[model samples]
Target: MYTIGQVAKFLGVSRDTLKYYEEKELVKPKYDDENGYRKYNPYDIHDVITTNFYRELDIEIKKIQEIKQSKSVTDLEHVLAEQEAKILEELAYKKRLLKKIKSVKEDYYKIKEHLGEFTITEMKPLEVKGEITEYAAYEEYETIRNSTENLKKAVTLTSARRVIHFDEEGMKEERFIVVRKIEDADKNFKGEVLSHPKCIYTVIEDGRFVNGEKSIDHEVGERLLKIAQDNGYELTGMAYINILLTTYEEGLERVFLEMYAPIK
Candidate 1:
């Protein structure tokens, strides 16, 4: 028979840990009443080793207790299966997170490379919905905040400027809007889809905020229009502004946006 100290040393665990296992009734060593001491036989040592094995696998103490008391192999198999399923789900989530990290890093590099540079390019197809005229409570806002899938597919907050309208005079209208990517597979989707064949694309920085609310600087709009006129591109009275990145510096929110002004 071995003492608690000898068992703990052999198992690479602390005596308190062995005492905790005793308290949990996971391993009950024989007690020497005359000597006022505990004694662990080889059988008790084997139990401690098995308990450590289950712990290394991250099995909870309660679950390990259940496993110890289980009479059939089926019961043990069921617990193992549950742990396996949970691990697989976590692994899949981490893989998706890694993919998103790589994509966002690439976008940051693109923003740095193309800031303030203008080029005529085709805009990606967009699906437009309701307009956000002012700051107030709305159903779409709540849905996007609460639903994970909808939030993931919400383009307006991540990559797209809600909406921008330009007429012959200049930028006529600008406001936030509820918008998402057009799903080709969804037959039920009936939102208006827009496509621009040619557009003057450029990235602009805006950091102006009014009354703690986000607002776009109109000067950027004038500059874009002037660039189009100077380059001899006929205006199409509309433009699409997409967001590339947003950052906070010195308590100020700065937005980096990509604009696509349609040209004839």
Candidate 2:
């Protein structure tokens, strides 16, 4: 026989926890009328130890009770097998989550390295791999990306919008590019393929100077033209703006973006 406190100390559990188990009918402690307290016998202590062992496996209290009440070996085996399956499933989920987290963290660091730098550089022509959402609104972009279920969870907002038109009522219709960086161009892409030549690429950050007025794409393009002329590089082809960073919550006001224009 043992008091609740004595058993709790031995099992490394609180008296309150043992009391809770008793309340849940998982353990029925003998009540001493003369002492006016709960008394745990050898059997009760064994039940508590068994309960604690199951709890270590993160098995639900009710499920642990069910396992304890199981009479036949087959019944016990069935419960154990179910728990094993659940643990395996949980392990797989956690592994995937960890991999995704690591990838996103790496992306954050990579993007951080590109911040606050403006220079003329030559970038390899990237293949527009994914199915581009043509003339999509911000909401439409989200709906389309969410449908695909391939968007990185850590990534927010989306890719560049080939701003065709913008008025007081916001964007009428604009092409949105879900840029997929790939070595070989995937031929399955249904969207229009527009690749940048090995030309001057200038980046512009979204700040007070740049906002969605007459399309930041045009603004950056014009600025790139000046840069090209000043640096003795001929400014020819149309500009392609690349959205670096943004949030769905922060419309145009608190959004972070960059413009990439092809210069001769």
Q: Per-residue alpha-carbon lDDT of model 1 for 3-65, expressed as tens digits? A: 999999998999999999999989999999999678999999999999998888788999999
After superposition, candidate 1 runs with Cα above 4 Å error: 1-23, 27-58, 126-139, 145-156, 168-170, 174-194, 208-214
Span of 10 residues, lowest total lDDT, candidate 1: 143-152
Q: Estimate the TM-score for candidate 2.
A: 0.64
- Specify the highest-lDDT model's number: 1
User: For model 2, how does the per-residue alpha-carbon lDDT over 10-55 read when each residue is reduced to its tens digit?
Assistant: 8899989999999889899989999878898999999898888888
Q: Which candidate is the best by TM-score?
A: 1
Overall local distance difference test of candidate 2: 0.61
